[model samples]
Target: MPRRAEPPARRATVRDVAARAGVSPGTVSKALNGTGQISRATRDRILAAAQEIDFRPNALARSVFERRSYTVGLITTDSFERFSVPVMLGAEDALGAGKISVFMCDSRDDPIREKHYVDVLLGRRVDGFIVTGRIFNEREPLDVSPGVPVVYALTPSSDPGDCSIVVDDAAAGRVAGEHLIRLGRRRIGHITGSAWFDPARRRAAGLAEALGAAGLEVAGDPLYGDWTEAWGRQATHILLRSCPEVDAIYCGSDILARGVGDSLRELGRRVPEDVALIGTDNWEFIAGGARPPLTSVDLGLSTVGRLAARRLLEAIGGNSRAGKEYVPCHLVVRGSTDDLPPASTGSAS
Candidate 1:
C-alpha cells in the first residue's frame, strides 16, 4: 500500500502569509493589525493570504509583547470533589474570559505530587496559581519560590501574609439560627461534624451567638459527631433527651440534616409545624428532595473560587493584597422551616 500521506506540514505562520501576499512580514503585521498606516488594498491582500494559508495565530506568541504567558495553574488537593468543583468552575469562568488558560492539577493531597506539578507549571511560566482543598482550613504555603503569586481558595495559607479566599462558616450558622428564630423556633439545637473541623466549630459558635443575642441558649451544648446521616439520627435522640423542649435543629451539613429530618418524622414530630430544621451547604438535590424541602445555608463556595481567581490576577498585575478574606454565606428558605402562602399569578378574574 502507498505510504500514508505526510501529516499536514506545520501550522501556517505570519512569514507564510507575508510570502503568499508578496509583502514583508512587518508590512503583513501592520496591515492585518491596523496598528500602522497601510493601504486598504494591501490590508485586504494580507487578509486573503492569511485565510488561504489557514493561519491560526498562536495566543502565546501574540501575547509575547505583553511579557506574560497568559496562563494559570489550578491545584486542588481533594481530587476535585464536590466542594472543589464549584470553586474550579468559578475560577475558570473568570480566568478563561480574560484570555487566560488554566492548567488543572490534582495533587490528591500528596506533597510529592504537588511539588511536581508546581515545578512543571513554573517551567511553563504560569503567571500564578490557585491552591484549594475540599475544606476551607489553613494549610502550608506552596513550595514555590518567592515572587510567584498563589491564592488559596476554600483553604487558607498558614502564613498570615498570604492571600486566602474562604467561606464564612460563622455566617452560615448565624443565618441559620436567625432564620429559625424568625420562624418562632426559639428552643434551637445544633448538631454538626467533628470539632476538629474549623467550619463545624465556627458554625456552632455562630449559632450560639445568634441564640444568645435573643437571650436564649442552645437547647444543649452543641453535639459534635461525624458528618453522616446516621450521626444525625443518633444525635437527635441524644439531644431530645438532654433538651426535651428543643424546637429546632441546625446541622453542619445537608446529609446530616436529612438524617435529622427522618428521625424527627419517625419520632412523630412534624417539620416546621413542630420542629423547624436547617442545614448547611444548601446542596440542591439533598435539600430539595426532602419531605418538606430543607432550608439551608449556601456557603458560596463558587464565590470563593471567583474571588480567589481575581486576587491571583491582581497579584500577577503587581497589586498583591495579603491575608485571609471571608465570603459571606446566605440562607435559602424552603418548606422545612417556614410555611408560606402560595404565590399569586396575575390572572383575570
Candidate 2:
C-alpha cells in the first residue's frame, strides 16, 4: 500500500472551507458561527467541508463574533424597582444559561449616571447591552459607538431603528376587556395611572378598542391619576359615582386593583357576584394580598428580559435585528373575577 502523504504545515483556514464547500468565506463564517441566514443545505455542506479539513476554530476565528466577551451589561433607570426586577431576573436567567455573565447597573433615571455606567461597561468590554426602564415609553438611545450592539427593553429608543423589547400593554388591556366582555359585563369602567404615561394611555385605548369592538364602551371615561393605592380608591369612588351600573372594572396596575378591591368591599359589592375586578402586573404579593384575591394581567416581564438577552446574543453574533418587539401578556385569574376562587394558595392566589 502507498504511504499516506503528510498534511500541510499550516492549519486550514475559513477560505479552505469556503473553497471546498463552493461558497464564500463570509458565508462559511456565518454558517460555522450560526450568525447570518443561510440555507440548511449550504450550512451543512460548509460544516461537512470544515470537518473534512480537520479545521479547528481557534479564539482568533471566534473573535469574528466580537471576541466572545460572553458578557452583557444590563442597565436600568428604575433602580431595580418592582416593575424592573422581574425583567432583570429573567434576563439574568437566560444569559446565565448561555454561560454569559451580566453586569447590572442602576442609572436611577439620571442621564449623567446612565452615561457613567455606559462608559464603565464599555470599558469592561461588554459584548452587548440591554437598557431597561420603568416606563413603557420611547427614550433617548444609549450613547454608544456604532457596531456596539444595544437593545432597549420596556423603554424603547426614540431612534425607531433601534431594537426594543417591551410588554404588549395593548394586548394586556384587550385581553382584560375581552375577558370581562366574555363574562357578559357590558358596563365596564377603567382606573389607571396618569394619562401622561404611555402605558396608561395605551392600556386605556386598548380597553376602549376591545369594548368598542363588542359594540359597547366603558361605563365612563377612564380616570387617570398616579399609580398609587390611594388613587385607586379615589378613582373607584368617582367611577362608581359616574357609572353606578358599572359591572366590571379594569385597573392599570395590581396596586390600583388592590385599592379598588377594598373600596368595592366598603361600597358593599361582592366581587364577581356583584362586580368583577381586574388589574395588570400579576405581582403575586399585591394580587394575593388583595381581598378576594385579584385577577391581573401578567405582562410577561421575565419574557421581556429573556427575549432581550436572546436578541443581544444574536446581535453579538452579527445577526442584529432592529425595531420594537412586544412580549405577549397573560391573564392570572383569581376570585376578583372568577365565580369561585381557587381553594389552594398557589399561583391563583
Candidate 3:
C-alpha cells in the first residue's frame, strides 16, 4: 500500500497579487504593464507583492493587449559573414537592451529569398526591421508595409529618403594615408580592388586627397583588380615595376596587404624600413597574423549596426529621420608601418 501524494499548490494569479497588495486587479495591471499612472508607493507595493509570490505575467496576453510584439526582424543579404555578422551582433545588443527579441534571416543575396523573409516577418507582426548587406552599395528598399519602419546598415537603400547608416570609406583611406605621411613616408602607391566598386574608388580618391594636401602625390596611378590575394600580388608587381621609388603602400583590404607584403619580401623590401604598409578593414585574423603585423584602418562596422538599431528603435517610437549617416573610421598601428616595439603598438584616431 502506497501513501497518497499531497496535491500541488495552485499557481498565483494577478488577482492574488492584487489582493496581497490590498488593491484591485486593474491597479495591478497598470503597475505591471506600466500603462495608466499609479502612485510611486502603490506601484512599488504591487511589484513587491508580485515578486513575493514569484509571479510571472503572461507575455503573450500582454502583447495582445498592447498591440506590440516587442520583436524585430533583422534581414541580411550577406549570409552573416565577416561584414554582416558584426552589424547583426551590434543591432542585437541594442535591441536586447530595449527588451525586444530579434528574428535573424539571411537572404543569401537572393531576391526571391529576401522577399519571402520579408513576407514571413511581416506575418509575424514584428515592430520594425534592420536591413544590412556586405557591400557599401545601395540596395532596393525593403518591400514591407508603408508604416513599418526600416533602417539600412552597411548597405544604403536605393531610395535616398530612407534611413541608412554606413561606414566612412573615404575616411578609412584618408586615415591610412595620413598615418603613413606622419611616418615621413612619401611616394605612396595605392593598390586595391576593382575600380567599379564604389568603396575602391572612394578610397583611392581619399588617398590622393591626403597626399595632395601634404604637397605630395601618389607614386603612380592606383592599380585596381579583384579583391583577392592573387590580384594583390599581381598589382604589387605592377606597381613596383613602374614606381620602384614607392616608400609606402596602401591596400584596400588586409588580404591585399598580406599579398603586397609577401611580394615586397621577395623583392628584398624591408617593411617599415624600405616600405611602410597600411591596409583597410583592420581585420585581426589577417592584419594581426601577417609576418610583421599590419597597420590597418577599422571601418567601424559594429558602430554602423548599433546606430542603425538605434535609428530603427526611434522610428518605432514615432521619431524617424531619413538620409545617410556615416560612422568614422580609426587606425590600428602595428609593425608593418611603425618601428615601435610590438607591445607598444595600438590604435590611433
- Cα displacement (angstroms), candidate 1, residue 244, comes to 1.7
What is the per-residue lDDT of model 2 for residues 1-349, given as tens digits with 9 covering 90 to 100? 9999998799888999999999999999899778899999999999999999998876544645656667789989886488678888989888887667889899998989999999998987788899998977899889987789999889999888889998888998899999998887888899999898999998998999999999998888899998999999888888888777778899999999888888877787778777789999999999988878889999999999989988988888789889999999999999888754312111110
Q: Which stretches of candidate 3 lie over 4 Å from their true place?
A: 1-49, 339-349
User: Which window of 10 residues has the lowest lDDT sum in candidate 1?
Assistant: 340-349
* Candidate that would win on lDDT: 3
Is 1 or 2 the stronger prediction by lDDT?
Answer: 1
Those runs of model 1 whose alpha carbons end farther than 4 Å from true positions after fitting are 1-56, 340-349
lDDT score for candidate 1 against the true structure: 0.87
Model 3: clashing residue pairs?
none
lDDT measured at residue 196 in model 2 versus the true structure, 0 to 100: 85
- Cα deviation at 248, candidate 2, in Å, is 0.8
Ranking according to lDDT, highest score first: 3, 1, 2
Tens-digit lDDT track of model 1 for 24-132? 9999877765678888898999999999989976787766866788999999988747788889899988897777899989999999999999999999988999999
Q: In model 3, which range of ten residues has the least summed lDDT?
A: 340-349
Task: Summarize candidate 3's per-residue lDDT along 1-349 as a digit string, tens digits.
Answer: 9999999988889999999999999999999878797999999999999999989988788789878889999988886388988888888888888788999899999999999999999999999999998867888899999899999998899898899998889888789889888888877999999887888999998999999999999988999998888888888889888887788899999999999998888777778787899999888999999989998999988888889999999999899989999999999999998753212111111
Q: Candidates' lDDT values, in order? A: 0.87, 0.86, 0.88
User: For every model shown, what is its TM-score relative to the native structure?
Assistant: 0.82, 0.79, 0.89
Return whichever of 2 and 3 wins on lDDT.
3
